[model samples]
Target: MEFKGAMGGIYRLTEWITRLAATNLLWVLCSSPFMFCLILKLLVMNQNLANESLQMNWAMAILAPLTLFPATSAMFTVVRKWVMGDTDTGVFRTFFKGYKENYKQSLIGGIFYTLLFVIMYVDYTVYMTQLSNLQIVGVIMLILIIILLVSMFNFFSMVAHYHMSIGQIMKNAVLLTLIRPFRVFSTMLGSAVVIFIGVKYPVLFLFFIGSVVAWFAFFNFYGTFLKMQDQMEKMKQKDEEQESVEDKKSDNLQK
Candidate 1:
């Protein structure tokens, strides 16, 4: 009986782990098609930045809406459903659902990120024109600010998928990052490692492999965080109910 109990526990643990991994894998697969769009958007943005004379034409204008909005919307659906423990939804369904629910938020978030990018560009351009003593410090501050903003923005966008109010989403995002620094740092480090490996090994489709691995890591980290959030909320509700019960009991005793 003891041996069977131990085996059962082990089996349950293994099953949980497997389910978590499978969820992440499904999200990664669903997100794969957006990779091309992401790359194109990056290329176009870079070109626009490098060549100031390029016309502010329709192509450049539509880049954010076309590539980022759809991709982000799809990601939101996959992540949200995964967080809700919906395993039956397949890759295509997740993508389509995400696109449908997150379209406006994604578009708005894209515009926000783009505006930040533009500000950074302007800051860099202004710095290039000056030879001040604080140039190095200014550049470093700008970079740090940009990184912080981007991280916060990403967290907000993810929270928005749950239809959270903007203020609540931002607050939750900031709190999560502050409280779960290890998870946030690990995500950043894992992404960096994947990119580095991809760049180092060019001949064997390393980029694709690395991207797949990174996506899995990111999905797992994000899903785990969402699960924890749910548990915390449940605990909070339970505590509130207990408090209410105690207050009612005290009132009855007084009466």
Candidate 2:
């Protein structure tokens, strides 16, 4: 009996891991184009020569959103559903559904964010050119801003998944970040490391690694959220059941 129980536990754990891995794989495949476009945008942004060709840079900037926004929005939607136990939705269906549903909002959000990023970049360049003394503070502020933006994106993705309004999503995201800073940081750091490795190697293995990382990060955020949501629901149910039982006992005594 003990051996059987232990074996069953192991099997269940393995199954859980397998499911997580499968979900991650699906997410990566669905979101590949967005990922590629994002990387390309980052590359262009990092290049000093990119600033020299204003038209080319603008073109890249414009294309980046057109290529990546809808895809990313769809990827997030699919991954959120998958994490919430909707295993029937295949990668293609999820991708298309997400893309179609979120196209306009994603486009608008992407344009807004991208414009903000460009403005920040120009500001940073101007500051760097003018002041050598404030470089460290500016760099630190830039890093903080990047982290905040990424967190906001994650929150918005969750909002999109849950069909929540942007305002509510932003509020919840801010609360979640304040309450669970470590988890948020871990997710971001893990994702950054994976992407960094992918970029550093830029070979097949690295591509695979980055894909795996992206998937893991996407699912991890949603999965953890779902688990917490489930737990809360369970607790609420239990409390209601207990209250009902107590009420029945009291009525019986009165009778």
The candidate that wins on lDDT is: 2
Query: Could you give candidate 1's per-residue lDDT for residues 100-183 as a string of tens digits?
Result: 666666666556656666666667656656757657855875875546553653453454355765445545655666666666
lDDT of 2 by residue, 47-90 (tens): 85555456555765786466555655665665566556775566
Instruction: Give, for candidate 2, the lowest lDDT window spanning 10 residues.
Output: 204-213
* Best TM-score among the predictions, by candidate number: 2
> CA lDDT of 139 in candidate 2?
85
Write down the worst ten-residue block by lDDT for model 1: 203-212
Error of 2 at 147 (Å): 2.2
lDDT of 2 at 149: 63
Q: Which stretches of candidate 1 lie over 4 Å from their true place?
A: 1-62, 79-88, 128-131, 136-140, 143-146, 149-161, 165-175, 201-255
- Model-by-model lDDT, in order? 0.56, 0.63
